[model samples]
Target: PSTSLLVDSMVKKGLFDRKENPRDRRSLCIRLSEEGESRFQLLYNGMKKRLDSLFGILSDQDQEDFCRIVDTLYTHVYTK
Candidate 1:
């Protein structure tokens, strides 16, 4: 899907607020609304709980290794 379409959909759903950028008239500043923040927090908490439960089946060493692998992936993606 196009980025503009996604942004327009989100704005229509009241999940995001789109404002004209003061410094650049052709640009827009998109931010999450309060409702979006609340929804995101709920989603994050649910995912965290599910991950915790899943990871609980692993041994201490395995869990540590899993975390290390995730950290490495995150760093690789963000630093590229």
Candidate 2:
């Protein structure tokens, strides 16, 4: 029911693998399964295509202005 339990179950089911981090070799690394990678890639591509179509009306300058506006809003809100 909890996240740790869910992660444990997923590990048992092999949807992810726990490996020793090569850089540290002492800490654990949660690596996605082959199936997980395939699913993730498919979902990512689908979302990206949808967003691209939605924003396609914007010119490059418009996109840049939107990003700056969003960043300013985020900074103002978060710093408040």
Best candidate according to TM-score:
1
lDDT of 1 by residue, 1-80 (tens): 59999999999999999999999999999999998899999999999999999989999999999989999999999998
Worst 10 residues of 1 by lDDT: 1-10
**lDDT per residue (tens digit) for residues 1-80 in model 2:** 59768778878877788887889976778888887787789999999999999889999999999999999999999998
Once superposed on the true structure, which residue ranges of model 1 sit more than 4 Å away at CA? 69-80
Model 1: clashing residue pairs?
Answer: none
Give the Å error, residue 59, model 1. 1.8
Q: What is the TM-score of each candidate against the true structure?
A: 0.80, 0.69
lDDT of each: 0.96, 0.87
**Per-model tally of clashing residue pairs:** 0, 0
**In candidate 2, how many clashes are counted?**
0
